[model samples]
Target chain A: MKFSPLLDELIRELQVLPGIGPKSAQRMAFFLLERERPRGQRLAKVLDRAMSEIGHCQHCRTFTEQDLCEICANPKRAAVRQLCVVETPADLAALEQTHLYSGRYFVLMGHLSPLDGIGPAELGLDRLAQRLDEEQLEELILATNPTIEGEATAFYIANLARERGVKVTRIAHGVPVGGELELVDGTTLSHSLSGRRPLE
Target chain B: MKFSPLLDELIRELQVLPGIGPKSAQRMAFFLLERERPRGQRLAKVLDRAMSEIGHCQHCRTFTEQDLCEICANPKRAAVRQLCVVETPADLAALEQTHLYSGRYFVLMGHLSPLDGIGPAELGLDRLAQRLDEEQLEELILATNPTIEGEATAFYIANLARERGVKVTRIAHGVPVGGELELVDGTTLSHSLSGRRPLE
Candidate 1:
């Protein structure tokens, strides 16, 4: 059963979002049309504004309205020579939430997926190399996810930074905080044991 | 931790959607800004078009660009005097998917909820009464949900229709198809038992 043309178009458009399928799109469409028209209008306006105004930060490639992202623009963040590289903006945000990382970030936007035609260029490795050459960075922290693509991307970036005479380090992988040893997967448990540190 | 102004505003706008919390909103905002910029722009355009063009159908109060909704505008549907009243456009869409009901529909848009300040007027009871008086409706099928609020709204409409000399009936409440009897809730089990019919 097909919906009205406009409603059908709206549903199709909604499916472009990650993880939203046809069923979810239909539900969202009905929801927008039925009860939350004003909210839908607001969403439309914000989406338009964000798309037109927000672009990749000139320094770190993170989303920003200005030429440089907020973090990149801030002088305090620039004082630190350590640069954290992440697979996406969400990853950067997650690291920022911890408030432990006082340095700047470089968002790769995506990992190297050869099957999907995503390579070093797609992940902006050349631009990153240029940034490393320009900035007097002491440490390069690879904070990509634990996935295969993330590991590959991290390895590629680590090699590039080491060749440029910069100290490169990968974020440690292990059982997460508050995670029970027995509940953690074997791979993670092994990494935790291998990377264990002595109490100061 | 605060996001960039544009990202923060986009996340807040995304939270207006039902079922989207702060975390989900942030994820959606990043997804739109990072890779799916064109899709986000298309969504914005579609939303704007839908909001501005679509309005309540003059006849059934369902969403439509025309004066009457597709179902009400159809000549074949107009021949049927059976009127199925649903609480929202989503409910009407669900019934239409079954392809069993060939009658017209009157969407209430919401149920009677005094706590939320949604009452008879908010549900457009006056317009429904007018429709009932104007049309030669044979059966007024109250297909509102079986929730407490839905039941109250259905009863109110049923009373008004009966007063206007129309045969009013409520949709049957029973165990859903393929539902296990043991797993069924007590209220649903009782309703199914009370509404039991002899096998033909």
Candidate 2:
């Protein structure tokens, strides 16, 4: 009457992923069964390994299989004497793609939101403090999101860095390079105006 | 420098599914890593089983683990003497949900598209012929899509059924129920007018 038991089960399990609805789930299930079985099997193998093996990087707290992530394991990166803090590993990857920062990184995994019971402890502030003490960092960059909780998290981390005599800087806020000035939000425009730098 | 090796592999493998791009794949990987580990592990298990075990039902050609699908295995359905043929399992499910038809089904899995080299053998027309002879089906209903290829497929199957002295019918092409007449496509509106039934 319905899809075979295993097929039905596969469709239901697929809905556990965000943004997958019933129709999309069915399509994905059928697609895998009809044509992409080998790829789907590989996805399963990779997913199993990643879910079981991947854990936080010991030094930077980003998702990794090893005790220390690649960036954290690099002596040259640590010798740069600066640390960039971000809300998620995705943010870290985005910044890394720019190749502008040679310093190390600390990924929060999530921003501070007390209502959801995510605070300094959950953000691994203690580990960050320990790193600051041992690494003797010169500067700390706050590259968390521009939202309220992100700002609050940045402010808290900034205070921690200041107490350790480490200079703290937040990424600049402005109209994005490819964006229209007239289309920019009022608050961002005001921040851009106040934080403006004159040409040499 | 990049996501940890396993995490990177997981993200890449996730993109093997249709409609998942790099960003969405990353999000799905992170989502599974961050909070849905158990569900992710279960998905891996189910996906493995479904990909390895599920195959086309021997009788109906729908995806199923069993040799014959539930409808095809049912004696009462066989005795109904009516057989509805559809393009896919999803289409069969749609008709089943309506509770309008009381018969077994044959799933083509795809329509006739010789330009893509999908010929009679590929559509399992030979198996369909075998079913017509063996099942003693009174009427064969073609529920394929109202597309050029679907029509061609229906016409071919209708010829097959006529050769075996079995009655053949094609589901009507018309303006859809619960749709506005003005917004209906010209082809569908014209078909609806030409295929109009007398109100009793």
Candidate 3:
């Protein structure tokens, strides 16, 4: 009933990847088996090592093999005393691309979702509080997404920062660059209006 | 500039999978590192095995770990003495799903394309010819795709079978069942008209 047992198992296992369905998985398997066996073997080795060896940075919780990530270990970044809290390492990467801020980051890994049982403790707020207390942070920048859950997580963290006399600020919400005014959502337009800044 | 050296290598190597670009590769790498490391490790092992172990069936040229695939090894399938020539193992699987063919198959793996330097030898036509010479085949069915290259391959193989005195036939081309006639293409419509059969 099956074509090849190993090929079938490979296809099934490949579906663990996001957005890859059975058809795509089959294509990938066939491509690897037919055209790129050596490359596929290399991928296997790297993928296995990445999965088994990579762990969270002790300081920032971003993925890293080392105890402290590069950003966390940098003394100059630490001297800035400006900590940007983001929901994931992907968000940290996005911010780093802009070259706008020279501060360190704390990755929460996920946002608060009570319905899904994700809460403050799950987001590592205790670890964040420890950083705030020990580092005497100048400011805590909230770069969580603008979703309802993201907003709730940001608000919760803001209260925690307030209790410790740490000033908290959120990334600005507005129309995205190159986006049309009419295409912008109502909530985003309202936030843009309320959070307006003076012209330079 | 990079997140982690190992993570970067993993993401780059993952791009060898078809349709996985930089963004999807990053997401896949992070998803494995974050949520599914155990499953990812298992996938790596299976993928490595599939890439390294799977080889073409000696008789049919279909993908299999063994020299003779399950279909080729079965005596009843060989007893049918019918051989279907297909462009790929995927096509064989598709035909099997219809449950209309109980015979064995020969997979070309790819159609002829002179521009790409693939010819009869690359397609293992010599191996196919050996089967024609030795098997005393009752019938040879051309089920290659309906493309120009598929047509040329079918024609070439038909001559080969004719010279060997094996009955040669082709799968028909027509409007697909359950498809709208108005939406059918001109070439397929013409083929349908020329290949028409009388109503039962």
TM-score for all predictions? 0.91, 0.98, 0.98
Candidate 2 yields a Cα-based lDDT of: 0.92
Query: In model 2, what are the clashing residue pairs, if there are any?
Result: none
Candidate 2 lDDT, A110-200, residue by residue in tens? 9899999998999999999998888888889999999999999999999998888899999999999999999999999998999999999
On residues B1-200, what C-alpha lDDT tens digit does candidate 1 reach at each position? 47678888889988776677898888888887777888899999998889778888888888777787788889999899999999888789889989999989999888999999999998889999998999999999999999999999998999999999999998999899999999999999999999999999
lDDT of 2 by residue, B93-137 (tens): 999999889899999999999888899999999999999998887
Task: State the C-alpha lDDT per candidate.
Answer: 0.89, 0.92, 0.93
Q: Candidates' DockQ values? A: 0.65, 0.91, 0.84
Instruction: Identify the runs in model 1 with alpha carbons over 4 angstroms from their true place.
Output: none
Model 1 residue A116 lDDT score: 95
Q: What interface-residue Cα RMSD does candidate 1 give after superposition?
A: 1.5
TM-score between candidate 3 and the true structure: 0.98
Positional deviation of residue A11's Cα in model 2 after best superposition, in angstroms: 0.2
Best by DockQ: 2
Docking class of 1: medium
